[model samples]
Target: MSDQSRLGLINENPIQNGLDAFRALFTSICTSRNLPSTIDTLRQLGVEDLRNLALTLFTSLRNLPVSGSLHSTSGSATLRSVLLRLITAVASDSFDFDRIKPLLEIAISENTQDAQIWDFVSTAAAESTPPPRSIASSLQQTPCSQNTSSFVNSSEYRQNVDPVLKLELEHLYVGLPNFHKSFFGDIPELDMVSEAVFRKCTEGDSPLFKEGWSGWPAGAKESDVLTWIGGLISQLEAFADNRIPTSAARRKLLAQPKTPLEGSTGKRSMDIGFVDSDIIYKPDTTDSRYRWAHILVVGELKSNPKADIASAAWIDLARYAREVLAAQDTRRFVLGFTLCGSLMRVWEFDRLGGIASEQFDINKEEGGLQFVATILGFLRMNEEMLGFDPTIVTTSGQKYIKIERNGQTECLIIDEVIKRAPCIAGRATTCWKAHRNDDPHNPLVIKDSWQYVDRDEEGELLQEATEKGVTNVARYYHHETVRIRTDDDVRNNVRKGLDVTKATNFQPKRTLPSNVGGTVSRISRQGRSSSSGVKRPSSETDAALPPSKRSYSASPTKPNLDVLSNRIHRRVVLRDYGEAIYKASSRAALLDALEGCI
Candidate 1:
């Protein structure tokens, strides 16, 4: 009898009592923040424990043909339960053994080490296969040999072979930044293992196994891997020929508690304590070449409900990469954040991070990628709103992407007017790289500055806007309604106005010609404090944009009254302190001259 049958489970009957029993224990342990006690196994006793439980189900040594993956046994009936649990677990924040180090390492090590008889493919090849080229010549010609670790400790090499999996879990074979470089040498990559598995099959000692692309971590070093794969073509050819037909009798397994589209009832709110400073990735790493992952967080409606590996790692990995980047960029300090609601919010100021460190704190430390995320989020909304209708920006809080059965599009509900905009958007490349023309909802999403092309006719639109009704100054400025105006005009307005004022006052006794290029000198002298976040204007700064980038307006135009108003505003701010200094200096000079005459 099957395990489910022996345990009194039947199809089409309620799975509630069994799954509920699982959930109660899982929640208790998680609430207690219990680390697995012995580290031998993450207990597989809960509904949410199904993630770790799935590992047990697939890789189990016993019941090979009955309770296994096609590569293993036959009667694994719990695939449906595990799938629902994985989807819900990933969507929420509760801990899963699969994501932890001890368990993950063990699982990876098993597939590579193959200690269990069921997993043991004939190692006639890996143990004895000759190197494709002469060993000496290959070692000599290889450029990487110089840096190769030469202290071949047999204990360390033998340590690579686990009873089932090595402690390093075969992943740090590539290297973990926290660990030394020669950690486990290298994990057998998927292609290398697949080739070895298939090659052994033709030698009569191999068992029949179903074949397909094992999910490869789509990461760095793919090209060189393909070259190594080329040497194993015969194994590929054989596996292609001997693969078993997928069973037609295999029936669809229903996800036990969920409807076809939704997730589980255990999609509960989780609490992750703030325990450590978040680290940033910087250029200071002893090993500058490190591989990290990035993830994009989508909203509830758009959140993926799949158990596939890549999808599962997306958002968390992106967050990991963001933290690493911030750590490296900031130096010494590690910043942490909370994955809060629809909005990306910072948790750095929480009681723990606020009081816990000596490096920096509430008064000294910097708010991190969480701050960056909030800034980018606002910037993303403005990119669309500014492009759709510059005037729409003042009301951008209402602009959002809407997905319908027909197509995806952005919707802006202004007052009662609903404006529909194209859902397709572009990604920000480096400030030096051209922006990418791609769909925003690319199953994989990344965060960077975003860009869009706005209609130049926006100024005319603004004029028409004001002509229709004259009191919307905030909307007009917010939208850059006169965005058609070139930066040259703004530059000239500032340089001819406040910049000129500051320079003239600084050299009170010396007369500098206004016609000369003192504009650059004047800009540099004011040296605005960093609080004004714009980069300081340089001497070589070009206020004149190319003709294509320069915007101009014609036809029934409103006077450049707003443009003039902004120029006046700049003059007012620039003049405030400069005027005060000039007045004080003039008073002091008069007093000094009167005293000299007496």
Candidate 2:
């Protein structure tokens, strides 16, 4: 068709002429070969128009008819290539382009016709502009460095992240449940630290009050505020130590202000951390001082009390939580808090995501008591209450995991950690090479991962495979869904008086075109276990599980509004087998291993 005819078609039936209109615009840009003119044309289009045009073009490219003529396919490929280049040229800091790039990249990667287009566009775009600042870069100017993996640090990580993994994290973050009360509600610890303790500590005659906090001066620096808070915590810690002599054995939770925690590079540091007093920290030395394992709780401080959850302070807190969780393998969750001036909120982060307490001001008597209770609660918590998995124990410099089967118990000594999940909020799978305490020579593999409550256990599938006489598969010994008191308590605490109508709806507003579909089918194939022959539940059944499992009996309101996915901790033991194929001694050995597996 002529250009005039294409334009006429677009004007006559804009909705129906989706592909044709896209083709015409694409052809004009390609034929003109004028970057400035193309940019001008793009500038003239409204943001919505640009978005709709990009979506329509992507949809057409992705859903091209299989039975179409070769010429038509070739034409589509050429059009796609030109459009990608055009997008690269015009890509900027604009909201519309930012949204379009990721979706366009997804389409290009899925399309086999022009798989190289992504790399070409990426390189071209990089040459055009300074690389976009990542979430990490934005916070680099802070007093302490927070950079860890590119996954948390840089925007470049987004380009390479597995789509399913990205989706999973997004789901967890969006559905992350937050509670209005403290993690420990009205515990004996609160009563132990009476309101009198707070009043006495901050009284006009007290040393802490002389330093600050009696009339906490306006425009006080964060460091000064932190020092004043530290004094109160220290007084409480000392009081606990005197009352409960055994508390000393658990190690003193000392507040370290502006000190870099040991784990990652020394550059990354938290504003304040509660660390064990037993460790001799040399802050002036080049080496890392306080280990993440020794750190009990992390805190972020902001001079501005108005800093909300969306502020950079909270973002930094979230990043610190991930770092702490990643560093401590035994940790099931991380406890943190944000002190934005006098406003304080405690946070708990697990694989499901984060839950935050309602913010309370520390300047008031009630808030001061709550603050004292919070510190006392931290001190009173046992190892389990602090989010440690009791089933995994350390004794005599050896780590052991207790696995139970049919009401019988067996201990496995963990020898080597084979793998650990890199991210904080997903399955967080960890694998270990272990041996039964009774039979020390033979090795077994223990796999620990978090699974959705409704999903089938891996042990069941392995048992099925063994029963069916499947060859070359590991033998299943035991599996258990781990039940931790803290997890249950967290759920129960959050569910109390939770009004579903007040919950924020995080479901995405835009849906992929029907023909284009989603990544579910692709993820299923990638996520399948080696025992692929094992039958699994249908998609309809899988779809039904979330709603049914997420529903709360207490709430008559819409349950879907509170959409957090509750994941159960699971561990399975299997007979050790072949090594990683790449670890084979020779190429021939690798081929033999592969053949046996096939």
Candidate 3:
């Protein structure tokens, strides 16, 4: 049993897989893990067709990995930003400008304090300065700004790969350098926006939108999405109102009123206008609505109870709603949840009581209408709660966009409504995941020492997760194990595991003498000193050294650094709102300018 013998065992054992299999396994694993995936060489380039040939590569796995582990508090948001940027850039189908570059710059920045990105960007700018000879003078017209008014303009948001941005990010980890490459794993459905609504395994009938929705060529998909987005914006504006509107005058009494006026339904609508005051006033101006709506939508999505939902699939739900609302109507809406076929709703905020309703299936009065479009893609409120009457269910009725939630639920809805519903004032200070477990046949596993984290607008913890040790909110990622070694039993088990994996000399490499007579220095290859032919220090002398200088402590009883850091957690990273803000407002002279403003 010697170091040489251990090496011999390592060399003797045959690897199960060949080089090709190994490469495939490595690539696939690396991508899913968001590890450092590498490319061997650069290959091709076209004007705007950017296919990163050798940029990053992953090997295809023979079969799906049943489970994956997440890096503790590597800070997913930091990486998510990069992946989103890549998604935006690729979908934009153009790269002549800095469409994704500046956004990328904002993500990985250490702090607003010292923007090292600016230095690299400046350098890239100098390097990529296009000559006037072949450059279109159009490039110099409107400079990029943080404002949507400026950034979304075809002229301003152009993806012309300003050489400066390319060079700036070349050396940058680019927020989540490997996130886009893998980290979250495969989502092939996102290849197209329509796929967000359609079930991948089961291709159903044509879209059931009203008659007018028919003639739109596939290209009009863009228009449809836009209409959905508009409605969400309207819903959000209504939610932002300092005060919410009252209930619909408890309309139950009036519904059965014996004395009725001529053309009552129409007047009832007018009654809703004149007398009834229950409504979140939808904003008259455009920007106010979507702004508030954006906040709410993001908050809810972050509040989801499952990790699978957090993947890019969730974005599809929001995006699809936006696209449909943009093309169809700019009003309140309801969508179908993917799971359990339930109805979901968003009430648009107007000066009047904002309108909202849950979607129902084909027939009136059917108990299980199955209005939910898809499951696992969205959260669904039971049909009984929404009270959407079919008598008034028209494509033109109050701007309801329908859509399928990202596999959680199904149904179409206006994009803006989805966006706005996120902000609508509701009972948010509740544990959604906990409530689900109370239902019959709940299967969500409860873990010990686990807790939920709900951050308020001011970045305060509003609520904690269930006491049984399960994460109800998806946002509370396994931010490092609170303790790698928990109880005494766990500590003992880990010690055993370590002993099994110890780099002991009993399993040595290369043929060595069966005897133990070898250099003491070689036995402790990594320790002590480099002074050749010098006697090693005694245990007493080693003990005299400071704690930091010692190679190993006398015992393995020390606490784990990761566990300690989690127990005494530090660092507060904000969400993407800053991105919207920085892009919209005038560039701050310093990052500190944002402090105390909210």
Off by over 4 Å in 3: 1-43, 49-126, 129-308, 330-598
- Indicate whether candidate 1 or candidate 2 has the larger TM-score: 2
Total clashes in model 2, counting residue pairs 3 or more apart in sequence or in different chains: 1
lDDT of 2 by residue, 28-94 (tens): 5435555443444554545434443453454344224321111122133233333323332332224
Candidate 3 lDDT for residue 461: 34
The Cα local distance difference test for each model comes to 0.22, 0.51, 0.21
- Name the 10 consecutive residues with the lowest summed lDDT in model 2: 540-549
After superposition on all CA atoms, what RMSD does each candidate show versus the true structure?
A: 33.3, 14.5, 26.6
Task: State in Å the error of residue 376, model 2.
Answer: 2.1
Model 1 stretches astray by more than 4 angstroms = 1-26, 29-308, 321-464, 470-598
Model 1 C-alpha lDDT per residue in residues 196-234, reported as the tens digit of each score: 444443345332222311221133122332332233333
Write one digit per residue (lDDT tens) for candidate 3, span 192-241.
32223222212237532333222223332323423432343233223322
- Whichever of 2 and 3 has more TM-score, that candidate is 2
Candidate 2 matches the true fold with a TM-score of 0.62
**Positional deviation of residue 278's Cα in model 1 after best superposition, in angstroms:** 20
